[model samples]
Target chain A: MSAAMTQASSQAMSHAATDKRCDVSVKDVEISFGRHVVLEKLSLDIAQSEFIVLLGPSGCGKSTLLNAISGLLDVNAGQIWIGGRNVTWEEPKDRGIAMVFQSYALYPRMSVRENMSFGLRVAGMPANEIQKRVADAATMLKITELLDRKPSQLSGGQRQRVAIGRALVRDAGVYLFDEPLSNLDAQLRAELRVEIKRLHQRLRATMIYVTHDQIEALTLADRIAVMKDRVIQQLDTPQKIYREPVNRFVASFVGSPAMNFMPGRVERGATGATFSLGDLSIPIQGYPFKSPGLTGAAVLGIRPEHVLSGAEAGPNAFNAQVEMAEPMGADTLVWCRTPSGASFSVRVDSGPSIAPGDTLPVSFPVGTLSLFEEGPDGRRL
Target chain B: MLAIRPRLASRLAAWVALSPALAVLVVVYIGCTTWTIWISMTASRMLPSSNFVGLRQYEALFANERWTVSVSNLVIFGTMFMIASLALGFLLAVAIDQRVRAENLLRSIFLYPFSMSFVVTGLVWQWVLNPTFGIERIGKNLGFADFKFDWIVRQDMVIYCLVFAAVWHAAGLVMAIMLAGLRGIDEDIWKAARVDGLPTWRVYVSIVVPMMGASFATASVLMATSVVRLYDLSVAMTNGGPGIASEVPAKFVMDHLFERQNIGLATAAATSMLITVAAVVGPFLYWQSRRRAAAGAH
Candidate 1:
């Protein structure tokens, strides 16, 4: 095995063995709307003070699961426990949680201070205590100067900060965020993304955020629950999720430019399994197989960055004609067709001046390739 | 150059399209208003005359007992109808917004009264409020001999009967406006309030109602205009009533101008009504515009 592959797997193994204290547990939850089942017997366990992001495409039931955890939705059959208490039927306020919404959801007529203090007042907290909590949250979110302004008077990012402040003032055990940064522009979104990470670090509170943005999931989550078709496909640390997705759906969903899949058949030899595509044979010597002696019709998945070029190639090298090269400031994406006529892309440093019609040698490391059974299920082999 | 010419041509076409409306405003609205003021200053009765009378007609108008009762009746009726309709409409809107089944049907039923003309509304209510044959008669027939619902006939309480009918006719329209406002609210606000542990009533009172200022303004302004022009209902229901107990300003003007043949007094009363409306509405409009400007500035 290559040294880099061994190091990556060892790191993922260490992340899995850190802690097991479950602060929030959703067990056998079933949710449906009329005739449509949103979540069917779904279960998840979130560690205390861990930022767990529910990542999926739209309509993948990630937000619905978050709502169920927040007690905003009632499950047909399941139990939700928070801090050792079963809160299956508890009111959202009594569930020891606070939430931020995609639209900010600030009271338009209320000042920022009032927005942050409203829940405390509703809970019958003393006025002075409410004032202190509001002050602390406002200062934490850096919205002290905006406390007197109505939400309509504040900029979009400022309004979102106030929304986060509203949740922070609740001082609850868990904080829920539902696509809170989706409404902002790219620059503001990146700025607030960093601030949310910083806030999570400072508060050390259990937070479950939902978004379709994989960048947000990768940067903000201690662990991500990647969902599709009303069930979580994989739940693991972000590195593990990216490096070793459990199924084809998760393999394609969590990466930029997506992992490329080449249809092939796994051939069993005396030494190891080799994947064959058209007329080209690629060795799969050190590939970790979930099942031993994995031999059958299979597909090989390679990330664009993993397709090394020039002298970085170690073995299994082949020549391909470049069809196009797109320079993207820091890097260039070269779209090429293999000698056997299979198309794929290679992400290389921008230092290379390679153009279309040029031939370049690229290597696909067997240690980094994701092999899946060629079928409707497409489970990783 | 081509783009500039097309833009100028569109601008000229827009002006040409708006000219008819401008001419109508100048001739029909401003011209009629000026002519009425001029007639109010002159001593004209049954025919237009050139003799100037000035404030003499105003003096006579203030001294008239029926006119005094009409003005006071308007004050009571307007205040009661506006407040009651707004409260009832807002309540109906809130109830309907609770994801009720058959919502479209209920909304249509509530707003059905607004579709009828005031004359029809007044006539229909006149039968329902006829003490001898309405609730009083029904109660007596049901074996209660002392049942009394004769507000339409009572001298001191006749105006309240008018208020009840006006509220019924107008509250439905208010409900439709309030419903639209309520629907425009983000669904997330309700979820936030729920998470805040706010009682449903408190949420409506503190958060939802304050957000519906525009809807309330629209409903109140419509009610105010109806109050100022409260002639057809009085005419159809009670015809200024027994002993003119249900008299209103518009009825007074109509009676003086056509029935009593007192054009001079009628024009004076019309001019007074116009001034009263302007006095109340002008400052309100100015305040609203200023508030809008302040919000825009931020």
Candidate 2:
């Protein structure tokens, strides 16, 4: 690892702990299996009644971090606290957290009632209470009829509801979901995602959900933690992570179709500063950011929506050849490329008539672009 | 043009593909049973005759001393062997599933017995259980000359020796079936049970074993069939010695058919064995269908 990368990882770990609002906080946690390091100095604070979503790509250590919090994995370094008590060495059940697995791990031979109440039954809960809890959770998931049915008899959606209900019956302070909706169809996933959100609101329970889908993160999270390369790249509210990402990785990762970028030079002029790409230069007219440090080597990052494609639009303008357009009835996403081979996209009222090889000069609006240092470090300035 | 249901073609093809197997099944299994039933009613010595004398063979079969002893031996041997094999196999499977090191090695050792012919297996177990030969000799070499494992010598105790050898022969196959079942189990059940604060033994008893229903069914069916058709192991191990002890249904039928020139009684015995199997298995199949239907409706 580079010295700069090492510094970033250490800095990320240094904020390992915060005042306990929820039951669990992980401080500078690092986990490795054999010679391969899976998570390094990962720090996260989960508050009570807060639904925190850990969003990242595969192998980015989001699940590993959750495992560390749940005591399923041992961290080579760092400490964990749960319920205002240090529980770094505690077992999973002792940590007061229940997990809804990605695959609904229902016992096939057991009826839905037994499936939900298996844990309680094993714990020697009274038969009456076990029955009551199973009934309550069955009613909550609208699975009263399904209580007598085995998991095999239920549909995918019902099984997922039952899985969630299994965790709910535990009444654990924190509920961890490990990409629980990844197995469902898109339509069912959307429906259950809303249902889970409503469930969180009504119950007012703390939930730590993990997924690679940023849409899910954006829709469900009170706070989103974007991870990359075994470290938390950025952790903030969904809006902040999208609007003001700390680095290039976070900026590109949290948006659909991702943010478009153009390698350019940062030029300082009389009125303000601007990013020069090809023959066109976009002036950073507002947003008081000093660009003298960026100099010539910097990347200009702008969201696709920020570029105006409609006839009636803002001051910054450039003519362009439209390459292609994808229409979705309400909005059309137009792909345009500059003569100098710089490409950008804009979503407008309707698509264009241009073909794939068409040339277009697209403008980069003022203050909508973010500048990043070029070469080895390449962090946002 | 005639219109067929969408699934008709595949259904037709399925029947077409199964015709040969279906023909053989009917001609061999059903035909043989009917023929065997016919021979039981005829007063035949070694060859079939047209003259029929009803129930004479069955009456004589029940009166025969050796036949009565054979029936008693089969019941004792089958019950003990099946129970012992199932228990030992399930335990071995559970032990191997504890993420033990050298799992494949352990599995191969358990499964190697299944690959051997019953001839070899019976011989090995007979030698091991021999009083003056194997166990006693080994014990004497270790300076304990009075180690008696002579169940093969006692008339009342010979069935137990047969059970020991049969269980040894069958348990390995049971272990393999159960291990496959255990491997197919979702990894999350272990985690969920652990999170539920269940101890290891409780998890196995309350969760793991109960969920392995399909595997248990497979093993039970295989073992039940073996119990009915048990022969080679008993012959090699005890030779029905110690006064007609350790005799099984298959051995009894064979002895009557070839050795004693009693085709009439042999066919009678075969018919009775078939009826016994149908009596036990008929209700079992019906119950399974009903349970499956009930499970499906919910």
Candidate 3:
């Protein structure tokens, strides 16, 4: 038994290494449900073995884009190319892809082993080859003991693991995940998130994951595509997306405690441009403006963590009064109003005892502030 | 001591609450059953007379040609009706589950026949299958001069007419139950199956049908009980006519009890039916409970 178990595990470990990985390219795909267009002219190119996340709020077409890529939903126009093959008109199975659903949609009556091998069996693969693939997937998922158990017999996490194993057994070119962790509880969600990251690292397969949760997008994705209102706002590395959001929606949709915005006007001077908030004017000398001579009504955006207070708020700091403090274990978020009467939050270390109604000196560093045009689109300036 | 008093008082209240149902069980159900069994053993004709006779009524009941025809006819009708209704109902449910247009209207239309009484169904089918004015006449009127659809008048084929009407009446109910089962399946399961490259029919047979055990059990049990109590339809439609071809066990018992005044044989036939139903239902109920226990263990 021990020898057989070792052989099975070794065979399982050796499987993913030899599997072929493929890049996916969605070229200007448009999808609509009747007249309600969910995605319009969306195009994205994902590299081989890269982990790409489509992140947005509900109804932002993140899941719709993922479905179009997986061929679960048809696109109205444009072609999808996977590994250089145009598979826009192909069925989901013919497109050489596998998918994991949020609800862990394992066949309720089948045991885990049968669930994993169902696709292969339907494709008329040899029985022994199907068995070997199922065994390898079960071993890799640490569900060998659960192979004989029905989905209803397993907990939520175990069921999701089996669902992943079911997708894994397909050994397809690209894998799609449609909010697979949303149904799990928080603790299990965190554990499975780490496991998925590790699985991607080991397998080096192209994966397209869709989720509204920013933490999962940041932690698991090699590139994050922040989408909103039927369009992709930005597609970049997680660090770049976080620090250099292209618009107001992308900045506000990502990050916990969200970026703060203060409406102000920028006036051109002989020295340079200055952002004037009430009576106080801050110099925008070294700031990278999209247009060098741009001067108009603009919004100054700053993350809570980038705001400085107390000793770090030196002589050039602005004055503010604390409104309320929200204690979040690692750091306390202090809500404050500047002397110009604009309200914002500052992230301060929990050690300092900041309270409501306390006067403090706060500063916004020139390097970290984002300037946006004041009207609706709020394009970065 | 205080707790014991409350417990005793609550027990008294419980017994008070349960007395009506308990009285009905003992007086109506068990009481009538025992009295019928006892009467089957005694020779009672026209009037009640307690004279012992050892299985004589049963022996005569089996020997009688009409009773034999009734029993055999019941077996054939029961088999055909159950199979036809279950298959047709499952198919109807599958068609409706394909995200069809006006689903609510279609479901109501399909289930409309079940809401009607069996006698109404039998009368409608009786007129529709009457060779002179029904399909045969219509076919002849519409230009087929040699059409002959007269199953209701033929002895060998009359049971099939009964099967047809009974299926039309009961298939709607089974469809409703199976439709509910189909709706309970997760939409994601269908997506997964499509991604798995399984044909739609294979998924329905291998995955969807197996998962609908409870719906099948409910529909089958209801159909089985209706099969046992199948008297009104035959009386309303055929009246066991055409030389007593479509005669059933319930009709046999009813005719002997009320019209023929052969109480002993009627009671005997009724007892035999009761035994047969118990034989089929006992194992079925046992299996259901065992399955429930097994599921609960998980």
Better of 1 and 2 by lDDT: 1
For candidate 1, what is the DockQ? Answer: 0.78
- Give one digit per residue, the lDDT tens place, for model 1 in B1-298: 9879999999999999999999999999999888888888889999878799878889999999999999999999999999999999999998899999999999999999989998998899889889989888999999989998998889998898899998898888899999999999998998888888888898888799989988999898899899999999999988888798999999999988898888889989999999999999899889989988987886
Q: Write the per-residue lDDT of candidate 2 for residues B1-298, one digit (tens) a residue.
A: 1456647887999999999999999999998989999999999888877579999999998898887888888888778888899889999998998889999999889988888888888889889878888887888889886767677788889888888877888898999899899899888777777677778898788788888889999999999898888888878877778778777778889998999898988999989899989999999999999998987886
B1-298 per-residue lDDT for model 3 (tens digits): 9879999999999999999999999999999999899889889886666898979989999999999999999999999999999999999999999999999998898899899888998899999999999989999999999989999999999999999999999888899999999999998999999899999999999999999999998999899899999999999999998889989999999999999998999999999999999998899789989989988986
Q: List, residue by residue over A1-381, the lDDT tens digit for candidate 2.
A: 234323332321212111223556888888999999998777788777788999999999999888888887888999998878888888888887888888888777788888888887777666765676677667767888888888887888899898888887766668889899999999999999999998787766688999999999999999999998888888899988888777788888888767877788877788677777787777865644554434576777778777765454455666776778777677776788765678778766654554566544456666566766675326776
In order of lDDT, best first, we have 3, 1, 2
Model 3 error, position A149 (Å): 1.0
lDDT of 3 by residue, A1-381 (tens): 334333433454435433544889999899989999888888999998899999998998998888888888899998899888999999998887889999999999999988998878878776777788788778778999999998989999999999999988877768899999999999999999998998888777888999999999999999999988888999999999888889888888888899999999988888777888888887777889888888878999999998888899876688898999999999999999988899999999999799899997888888888998886669898
TM, every model: 0.94, 0.89, 0.91
Best by lDDT: 3
DockQ of each: 0.78, 0.61, 0.76
lDDT of 3 at B101: 94
TM-score of chain A of each: 0.92, 0.89, 0.93
Worst 10 residues of 3 chain A by lDDT: A1-10
Clashes in model 3: which pairs?
none
Task: Itemize residue pairs with steric clashes in candidate 2.
Answer: A22-A48, A23-A82, A23-A83, A320-A360, A320-A361, A321-A359, A321-A360
Question: Candidate 2: misplaced stretches above 4 Å?
Answer: A1-21, A127-132, A135-139, A286-292, A350-362, A374-378, B1-27, B289-298
Best by TM-score: 1
